[model samples]
Target: MAAANGRPVAKRRVRLLGGLAVAALIAGLGVFWAVTAPRAVSAERLAAIEAIEADPARGERVFWAGGCASCHAEKEASGDDRKRLSGGLRLTSDFGTFVVPNISPHPDAGIGQWTLDQFSNAMLAGIAPGGSHLYPSFPYASYVRMSDQDIADLFAHIKTLPASDATHPDHELKFPFSWRRLLGGWKFLFFDDAPRTELADGDAQLQRGQYLVEGPGHCGECHTPRNLLGGLKTDQWLAGAPNPEGEGRVPNITPGSPSLKSWSAADIAYYLESGFTPDFDSVGGSMVAVQKNMAELPSADREAIAAYLKTVPAR
Candidate 1:
């Protein structure tokens, strides 16, 4: 049998089967590519949103809350050294060693040229200026919860940091993980920019605490255990986990946990402010850096964090 324009047609059934297979293949490829494609923060949306004038003073507060200096400051730096945002810290993990990038104000080396919009994308959306996916190691996943005003202020504060010409080597990651584009696939599965928690109307202090705990503070990134794919187990929240960077265990902050059940909210606040456990033991490990950051916060903010933590369910 011959069709009007075809040389020959074996059978309509054969054609239908072949066409279906081709369609399925195309559909599969399309889905694969779509899931693998990296997404960027919408520049148009960023532009349309009204940003408050950034205040360097306010940004200093945000900087402390976000703990930017812990990672960006020179390794083993103390005192005045921490003010310099010349990143060279080496973070180790199962995936590989990540060499932190320079985030200083140096035009050639740092993010000096990055626009506010680009910084927002980097901090909140985990997208770089050139639209590359930043690893969750940078903790932008938690930063996503930060307010627009905070982001603006933080950016202004960062700009005021002294410029450094220091350069660091690229992240030394193993196969597949070393590929930056592969992060698109990871982002598809885990990256979410939505609000992590919701609070009732009013109660400004509690609300501020919630923002700090869930946002720039990024408490869960360390405290929450991760799934096999490296996504945080939100159900567990801050129930604690084995540290991926080392052998130490990340402590559970939820009040329900027997470990922290004895400690009152005031105890938590005091610890945050002074790095002294209820037992009067000094803080250590990765938390040392975090405690230093928390200490910089006002006593009110620290108390607010404690108040918010008390509201969380014990695991």
Candidate 2:
């Protein structure tokens, strides 16, 4: 009789322990969901962004400054064709191959239907219209620093571009990296919109340069080395990095860099405008496209970029 009673007690203990384990699992899942959920721009901020008037003419400047065509336009597109914005570029990285999507104004294949509010959210918060997180490969991380007016203007300019039905395959990422929801945690750790470098004395030219480089130009995205988690190493800002695409290295543009140490501010600006370095080496490789974009900008903007590069800490 005592053995029979002890068996029942043991069974009840097992049931209690199993229930506790299930409860703990549910709680853990709840925490994971909460942490990985996408966060859009707040309604109040969206309202302010909407209040700004958009100008396509001014946005054209932002377009060049941001180098949208470098990735969004066709790889072989040139001259007027560059305005098509039919994205088919393949960006290969350690994570996987990220095919650039069609950002043209087509209603279905492109973002033609995305409202200004949607665009603002995508640019500033890295959230998609359907409330999914966008992969940082889109460079919205750098765009997060853009001003509301600039974002509005960029949308207007993009709307004016010719629409394309061009489509590309979805990103091919490895397991775990393939999961989009996990990006929420990544953003929480490294999605900083703050200025990467603080200018001394708040000089106006340096400030403009900083805005162009950090906000729209996104030069550091390539120049700065990333951590194991793909976060930018702030300490090495604009110091050359291993080329994510291949074996070579992105040259260091900081003042202390040997390659650029002797380059005068004028030399830098002239190279950007003319695609010829101080030593008369014509721009080559991936920078060929970037130099072309820089040539289209006003001379003053290029000079501002040069002045800013000269001031950066030598890496």
Candidate 3:
């Protein structure tokens, strides 16, 4: 059947037409999946849930160290008090805006029902529980280095958090970037299975920094730029990159990168504790939120992070 433009019309024409269109769309979707899903899973994918069920207490520590709650959960509860890992923090970027998802333990809306392997894949592989590639905004690149035992414990603690049944806002990304299936190609370009295998010798401070930046802190997720394929631009490591907040830059932290070099290790540590960078300028943007998390950590760990920063080769 056709509209008033004068095509033939029958009593059941609308129903048949709609059904055929849906069938075609479904066929197209099937084809799309056939092309996309295989690359999302790696042969090295983690094995089971039993691994993550150990040491809930230690997992809680890893959660804090990893700063999971800062990004996954809302900074403040909403009127409905439904902001625990239900997602929906809009992160604007040059390519697109992303809404962070709730990772709380809500059975229906959160990670409560995710199997251990599913959690492992998301953290280690940046693929969601269903084998779909997650946007790098989740920072699994840094997370991939995390020890399996630690990851498992982290998941255990996550299960104990208060659940929120809140629904999240859908991401309204722009063209090309909006095609989630294309993420497989993006993952191939940026994601890797090889974890950090070595650290700088003779520098305990540097090693600590390396662990914090690459693992729990995940600073590179925002501080590093992406190549054409959306992988972190390692050549420009920590040299400054655009952030979703206020279009402010994640300033270059490398020694001579025009941002952090002038500050002493003490300056860095104090700024972390009080949100005051050198020159008395207040830290802002993502760093503000980051400091909130850092302030909660022990003084020694924070200082260790500072020591590590000092060891970064001057740019």
Candidate 4:
């Protein structure tokens, strides 16, 4: 009953408001569940890796291909000092600062206690040993494209690194971004294990380059511009992007850009090996770490990467 104007309240109005409230509650619960759920690798994929033995010798290639040393190794480390995996490198981004954790064999400070499946899950699915979501700063999005064997070999090689008992500092994030559960929703949208592009021409060398660049190398994560959600702009491919950590822009490596249009496949290979451009300029900036990793690869692999880069359509 309405007391103020001496009018009776409508029953239909009350029922309509009640129904709307119930609907809103249901919608909120659905969103909550979607963001909190844990997504992991398939059992079939796990069984595939489990079926074969890992080769640590070949695993060394996987390690360099993945560039584990660049992030996991000690900061300011040069020469043999790069071998120490006592993590302290700080990756500063707009959202927060992520401190790379020690991935060495130290039981308390690293992943020494982790099983191969746990490592595989972290690489492909971005899930941690405790079943929580890992930050995208780890670049698992591209790693999702890796084959089961490559993951196995990489894990084997990681085991061979010397142990470090370094302390791992937690990441500093702004409110809401600090929540790990929210990453499930982020993963649901951006995490696909499929290769970004398929080679219509079926060239073997180009295919190998595609595998290396799209999968473990994760070139697009740095070279391609990102959307507001931080997902790479696939249509643009390697057309260049701003450094999330600030400062200089990442160069466009796609074909026909003036900077690289004149360079032959041999020139690109030489740059990867020696860090020198055709103009005789040495590689600098964050690319320094990647060039070092590329130098570790065989001459054939460097040439293969160049061959693939030459064929990409200019933006």
Ranking the candidates on lDDT from highest down gives 2, 1, 4, 3
Query: How many residue pairs of model 3 clash at the backbone?
Result: 4
User: How close is each model in CA RMSD to the real structure?
Assistant: 3.5, 2.4, 9.2, 2.3
Tell me model 3's lDDT, rounded to 2 decimals.
0.71
Per residue, candidate 3 scores C-alpha lDDT tens digits across 12-40 of: 68879899999999998887666566353
Candidate 4 regions off by >4 Å?
1-11
- C-alpha TM-score for every candidate: 0.90, 0.93, 0.78, 0.93
* Model with the higher TM-score, candidate 2 or 4: 4
Error of 2 at 37 (Å): 1.3
| Cα RMSD for predicted model 1 | 3.5
Model 2 whole-model lDDT (C-alpha atoms): 0.90
Q: Least lDDT summed over 10 consecutive residues: which range in candidate 2?
A: 283-292
Clashing pairs in model 3, backbone N/Cα/C closer than 3 A: 85-102, 86-102, 87-101, 87-102
In candidate 3, residue 310 scores what lDDT?
68
> On a 0 to 100 scale, what is the lDDT of residue 19 in model 2?
97
Per-residue C-alpha lDDT of model 1 across residues 1-315, encoded as one tens digit per residue: 236635445566678899999999999889877876667667665764335777989999999999888899976677767779899889988789999999999998999999888898888788888877788899988998888888888889899999998888899998889888778778888888665555655688888898998899999998999987678888898999998778879999888877788989899999988989899998888888888889989999999999888887668
Question: Whole-model Cα lDDT per candidate?
Answer: 0.85, 0.90, 0.71, 0.85
User: Which predicted model would earn the best lDDT?
Assistant: 2
Question: Who wins the TM-score comparison?
Answer: 4
